[model samples]
Target: MPVTLAIAGLLFATGSNSARTDVDGGRQEELSGLVSQENRKVDAYDQQVERMQREVDRASRARARNDKVAARAQERSDELGRTVGLGPATGTGVRVTLDDAPRTEIGEGNIPPDYLVVHQQDVQAVVNAMWAGGATAVQVMDQRLISTSAVRCVGNTLLLNGRVYSPPFAVTAVGPTDRIAGSLEREPGIRVYKQYVKTYGLGYEVERLTEVTVPGYRGTLDLQFAESGR
Candidate 1:
C-alpha cells in the first residue's frame, strides 16, 4: 500500500511539472511577440516624424525668403547650427582608434580580464582631450558628438546615442592635428591607458587625415523637460 501511494504521488508530480513548463514557455513566446510588435510600431512613428520635419523645414525656408526679419532669424539659426553640430565640419585632423587586447593575449598573465577591455572612461578621456585641443567637431564611429551626447560602455561594447558598437572604436576630430596630438600625449588618463596598452597588447592607433568631414547630427533634438531658473 505504501509503495502504491509513493508511485501515485510521483506520477502526479511529473504531470503537474510538465503542464507548468508548457504554460511558462507559452507566456515567454507571447511576451516576445508583443515586444517585436511594439518595436515595429516605433519604427513607423519615427519615419512619420522625419517626413513631417522635412515639410516644416521647407515651409520655414520659404517664409525666410519673403520676410526680412525671418531671413535674419534664419541666418542666426544657421550660425548656431554650425556651432551646435547641426552642420557638417570639414578640416584636417587626426583619427584615433581604441581596441581591446587580443583574446589570445588574455589569461596568459596574472592580470584581471577587466584590464584587457576598453572602458567608458578611456573613450571619454580621449574625447575630452580632443575638445581641449581645440577641435571644431568630433565624430565617434560615424556619429557626430553634440553637447548632450554621452558615451557609455557595457561589457566590451560602446553605447552612443541609442546605437551600440564594438571595438576597435574610432574617434575622428576636425581640428589642428598638432594641437590635438599634443593634448592627447599630455592627457593623464591617456597616459595610464597607454601603460596598459603596452603591458596587455591592447590596440591603439592614430592616423592623420588630410581632409575629414564630421557630419551633422541627425538625432532628435527635443528636450524632454526644462526648468525655469526664476
Candidate 2:
C-alpha cells in the first residue's frame, strides 16, 4: 500500500522512466525552452505581487482614518498569504532528500532497474506524507507547493509545475520536526520507498533544521480548467 500510494496515477502524465534521461536532443531543447519561459513567467508574477503588496502597505500606513482597521486588514492579508504559500516561511522543520542510487552492482541482485532511480511518486510520497503530518508548507527542489501543483516524471527527472529537476530531490517542511519525521516513518508509501533505500542504496536522508525558509509560490493561481462533477 505504501508503494501503491507512491505510484498513484492521474491525468496529464507522460512516459514512465528508467535510469536514463528522457529529455534528449530536439525534445530536450523544446522542454528547456518551455521551462525557461515558465520560470520567467513565475518571476514576473512574483514581482507583480510584490509590487502590489508594497503599494498596499504604503497606502495602509498613510491612511490614519482607520489605523486599527488597516492594521487588522493587513494582518489578515499576511496570514492568508502565508497559508496559501504566498509568503516566505521560516521555522523549525525537517529536510528529507532523495537521490537515485549509484549505477553499480550493489543490491542489483533481484531488484528491478526501475527501483534503482527515484521517481515522481517517490518524491510525491515524501511530500504528501509531510503535509499529512501537519507541514505548514513544503518545498520540492526549489519550488514551493501550491494547491494546484503537480509532480510528474519524464524519465528519471521530476517535472514540477513547469520545471524539470534532477535529484537528489530535497523536500523540506516547516513544522514540528519530530512530527514530520514520525509522519514519514509511519507513512506506508514512504516506508515502501525506504525498503528500496536499504536494498539499493537509493537516497533517503533526513535532517532536522532549527531554521529553514520556504519561499512563497510564484506561479499563477488561475485555473485553466476543471472537471465537471457529472
Candidate 3:
C-alpha cells in the first residue's frame, strides 16, 4: 500500500511539472509573436520616414536650381543694360535724328502712303551703321538698344525691343566721331535714304555730342524652360 501511494504521488508531481512547462511554452510563444508584430510596425514606420525624407530632399534641390536660374538671368539682364548705356553714364558720343519728310501732296500712282513715313529698316540701317563704326554703346529714343533687341516697323509705327514709338526717332551712340560720320556717309542704304531726304525733305542730322549720357535697358527676364545639361 505504501509503495503504491508513493508511485501515485510521483505520477501526480510529474503531471504538474509537465503542465507548468506547457504553460511557460505557450507564454513564450505569445511573447515572441508580440515582438515580431512590434518589429514589423517599426520597419513600416522607418520606411515611411525614409520616403518622406527623400521627397523633402528632392523639393529642396528643385528650389535651389530655380533660385540659381533666376540669379543668372538677373545678372545677364544687368550686364546687357550696362553695355547699352541704359545704366549710369560716363562717356562721350554722337546723336543722330531721322524723321518723315513733310507731305507735299497726296499724289496718286507714285509711292504707297506708308512709304511717305520712315520705315523701321531705315532706323535699323542707321543703328547698324553705328555698330559697324565701333560703337561701344547705343540708345534709341528712351530705350537702350542691346544685341538682342530688334528694330521693326509696321506701317508708320516703329517697334523697338518689343515696345512701340512714333518717329522723329533719335539714336545716340558712344564712339569716335570721325568713325561714326564716315559710317553714316559710307552706308549704301543711308545714301538711298538721303535721296528721299532731298526729295521729301525728310529730317536727318548727325551731331557730335561732347558728353552724352544714355539710359539703361529696362525689361523683364523670365525663364520657364531650359535644357538639363545647359
Candidate 4:
C-alpha cells in the first residue's frame, strides 16, 4: 500500500508540471504577438512619414522651378559651388593618409594613453597642414571639401561632413606638391604623431598625384537660420 501511494504522488506531480509549462508557453506566445503587432504599426507609421516628406519636397522644388528669382539664384549657386569644392576638381597634389597604430605590445616609454589611437586633432592637423601648404582643393575619403567642411572624430572613426569612416583615413588635396609636403612637415601636431608612429606602429603615408580628380559636394548646401535676439 505504501509503494502504490508513492507512485500516485509522482504521477500527480508530473501532471501539474506539464500544465504549468503549457500556461507559461501560452503567455510567452501572447507577449510575442503583442510585440510583433507594435513593430508592424511602427513600420507603417514610418512609411507614412517618408511618403509625406517626399510630397513636400516635390512641392517645394516645383515652386522653385516656376519662380524667375529662383532661376537667377541658381546662377550664383553655380559660382559658389565651384569655389567651395562642390564642383569636381582635378590637379596635381599631395595625399596624406593617417591610420591608427597596430594592436601590438606598446614600446617602453612615458607614452600617454592617447598614443594608441588616432584622434580628431591628428586628422585635423593633417588637413590643416595641407590647406596651409596651399592645397587648392581638399578631399577626405571620396568626398570633396566645401566651405562648410568640418573634420571630426568620434571614438576611433572619423566623421567628415555627414558620413562616418573607419581607420586608415585618406586625405587628398589638389595643389602644389612641394608646398603641401612642406606644410605637413611643419605642422607641430603631425610631428608628435610621427613620434608615436615609431613607437606604436601608427600608419602615415604621403603620396603625390600628378593628376587626380575629386568629386563635388553632393549634399545639401542650403542654410536655414533666423536672426537672434528678437
Candidate 5:
C-alpha cells in the first residue's frame, strides 16, 4: 500500500508541474505581443515627426524666395544691400584620413581578424570629435556635408549622402586646427588606432589646409505625416 501511494504521488506532482509550465508560457506570449504593439506605435510617431519637419523647411524656403523677388522689384536699394560679392575664401583647418589596417599572418592566434579592418563607428567617432571641437563645417569625400546626412558602412564601403565610397576615407573640417587635432589625439579609441597604425599600415594623417570651402546643403525637403485617419 505504501509503494502504491508513492507512485500516485509522483504522477500527481508531474502533472501539476506540466500545467504550471503551460500557464507561464501562455503569459509570456501575451506579454510579447503587447511589447511588439508598443514598438509599432513608437515607430509611427517618429515617422510623423520627420514628415512635419520637412514640410516646415519647404514652406520657409518658399517664403524667402518670394521676399527676395518683391524686394528686387519694389526697392532698388534693398536689392543692392541683399546682393553681396562672391569672393574666394580660405580657411585653416585639419584633414584626417582613416584606412584599414594591414592584415596579419594567420599562423598564430595572436591577433583577431576584426582587428585589421576599419569600422564605420571609428569614422563616426572622429567626426563627432571634430564637431565637438567647434567645427563650423565638415565634408567627407567629394560631397558636402548636411545636417540630415548619415554616414554608414556596409562591409568595407561607406555610404554618405546617397553616394558610395571605398576605404581610405578623408574627413575635412573647417575649424580651429589646433583644437580639432588635439581632440582627435585625446580620444580614447584613437590610442588603440595608433597601435594599429604601428602594427599594420593603417593610413592616418592630420594636415592643416590653408583653404577649404564646405558648400551649403542641397537637397529636397519633403514632408509626409499621418493624417487623422490614415
Candidate 6:
C-alpha cells in the first residue's frame, strides 16, 4: 500500500516526461483538481459510514437489552474499542506543524534541494515522540492514528491513510502537554530537524493546545497475512 501510494505521489508530482517539454507540464494544477475530487468522494463515504455505524450501534444496543451474553460482549467491545482508538480522544496536548523551507536560489553554501523539504521520517519522528511521551491519541493531518497507520512521503507531499496532503502538515496529539513538549525537544531526529530549521529555515513550530480532539479511526481494521506453504 505504501509503495502504491509512493507511486501515486510520483505520478502527481511528475507527469509524463515524454508528454511534455517542461518538468511539471502544468500537472500540479491537474493534481490539485484530482485531490479536490477525491476529497469529496471521501467525504461522501464518511457520511455513509456514519449512517451505517449508527444503525449497527442501535441494533447492538437492542440486542444487549434482552440478551445477557450480548450485553457482556457489547460492554467488552466498547472497552476494547476505546483502548484501540476506535473512539474519539479529547484532552490537552500539542499541535506541531511542519513545512518545507521556502524555495531559494541554488548557489553558494551548496545546500541540497532535499534539505528544504519535509520527509517521511521527519513526520514520523514527531508522532513517535508524542507516543513516547504517553500520548493517548495522535492524529496526522485529519486522520487519527492506529497501530497500522503508516506515514509516507514523496517529494514534499505527505501520504497518510490513502490521502495526499501538501506541506504545512499538522500533527495533533492528546496527552500530557508538558511531557510531550519535553519529549519533542529531547528527540534526536527532531533535534537534527531543528538544526536544519535553524540553518536552512525549514518550518517547524509546536503549539501547546489547551484542548484538542482526535477523532476515532474510521478506516477498516482487517489485516492480511501470508499463509505458509505446506
Which model scores highest in lDDT? 6
The weakest ten consecutive residues by lDDT in model 5 span 80-89
TM value for model 3: 0.57
Highest TM-score: give the candidate number.
6
RMSD each, Å? 13.2, 6.8, 36.4, 17.8, 18.3, 3.8
Error of 2 at 115 (Å): 1.5
In order, what lDDT does every prediction score? 0.78, 0.75, 0.67, 0.72, 0.62, 0.83
Worst 10 residues of 6 by lDDT: 10-19
Q: List pairs with backbone clashes in candidate 5.
A: none
Model 1 scores worst on lDDT over the 10 consecutive residues at 1-10
**Per-structure clash totals for the candidates:** 0, 2, 3, 1, 0, 0
> Whose lDDT is higher: candidate 1's or candidate 6's?
6
The alpha-carbon root-mean-square deviation between model 6 and the true structure, to one decimal in Å, is 3.8
Runs in model 3 with CA error above 4 Å?
Answer: 1-86, 105-111, 221-230
| 1 or 5, greater by TM-score | 1
The lDDT, on a scale of 0 to 1, for candidate 2 is 0.75
Better of 1 and 2 by TM-score: 1
**Candidate 4, clashing residue pairs?**
86-216
Q: Candidate 2 has what TM-score?
A: 0.70
Native-to-model Cα distance after best TM-score fit, residue 97 in candidate 1, in Å: 0.2
lDDT of 4 at 230: 62
Error of 1 at 122 (Å): 0.5
Rank the models by TM-score, top first: 6, 1, 2, 4, 3, 5
Candidate 1 clashing pairs, residues 3+ apart or interchain: none
Alpha carbon lDDT at 204, candidate 3? 89
